[model samples]
Target: MVQDAASGDVVAAGTSGEKKPGFFARIVIFFRQVIAELRKVVTPTRSELLKFTAVVLGFVVVMMALVYGLDYLFSWVTTVVFGVPA
Candidate 1:
């Protein structure tokens, strides 16, 4: 017996006499909700798009450099431990 927090109304989980919507009715409801959500989307301007792209590319480049340095350091450590000739 769950109750709505705002309205203090008892939430009916298929217990009430009301019947759930049919398959097609649910499909219509789904599209309505999707359209409502799509309306909230904001398209970035050209300047904002360029800034976002530059930030993402800069982050990727920094990550690649970090990974390369770590790989080189680990390879050197492993070589020293196993006495592998480099």
Candidate 2:
């Protein structure tokens, strides 16, 4: 018998003594737990969702500008190293 870490239940494993739940039992238990958890989720209001979207978009734009600036700097360095064509 193996003791569960959180609940301290005496769980028995198969002959191998690995203490894992069987396949179908695990799937059913997983879905049951998922449904129980989904019942507790609190979705944000429309205004809050819009605010989050705006923040994400602003962050993405700033990252893009930073990447473009770095690309231009590297290109300038490479051009200078190889010298202007004419």
Candidate 3:
């Protein structure tokens, strides 16, 4: 029984007691919503993009180093456990 504030009607959660629209109609509605949302996007500045890229790269490098260290540690442990000549 949740009512929309502006329309004062019970908004169906993707399903009301109504028949679904046809396939073409649904597609048109989806693209209309997409265009509407795309209009609201604000592009980041060049400096902001550069800073975000640098942070992402730094995080990836740190994760790579961590995984490499763990891999090396496990290899050493296996060698010692089985006494394999390495």
Candidate 4:
């Protein structure tokens, strides 16, 4: 048997005499910890958020242009190989 350093409560190491926390008790404990953690979250300001959104939109637009260029190049090559219709 070991005593908790701060609380001085006796804690058993193994399953011999320990009572398990119930399911609902575990869920409540989990939510309490989540709320405590969320309280520490820092949200981005409006300017920072706008900058991130712009960067993402720019990247998507560049990717779309690249894909369209590749598609057009392939279509032109296929027409040349198979011969274009008169």
TM values, all candidates: 0.78, 0.72, 0.77, 0.66
Question: Which digits, one per residue and each the tens of the lDDT, describe model 3 over residues 1-86?
Answer: 33466777987744455566789988998899899999999999999999999999999999999999999999999988899765
| Candidate 4 global CA lDDT score | 0.87
Query: Which regions of candidate 4 deviate over 4 angstroms?
Result: 1-18
Clashes of 3: 0
Q: What's the lDDT for residue 61 in model 4? A: 100
lDDT (0 to 1) per candidate: 0.88, 0.88, 0.86, 0.87
Better of 2 and 4 by TM-score: 2
Candidate RMSDs in order: 3.7, 4.2, 3.5, 5.8
Q: What lDDT tens digits, residue by residue, belong to model 4 across residues 1-86?
A: 54566787877744345566789987997899899999999999999999999999999999999999999999999999999888
Rank list by TM-score: 1, 3, 2, 4
Clashing pairs in 3: none
What candidate 2 gets wrong by more than 4 Å, as runs, is 1-21
Q: List, residue by residue over 1-86, the lDDT tens digit for candidate 1.
A: 44556788998756654667889998998899899999999999999999999999999999999999999999999888898665
As a whole number from 0 to 100, the lDDT of residue 85 in candidate 1 is 64
Backbone atom clashes (below 3 Å) for every candidate: 0, 0, 0, 0
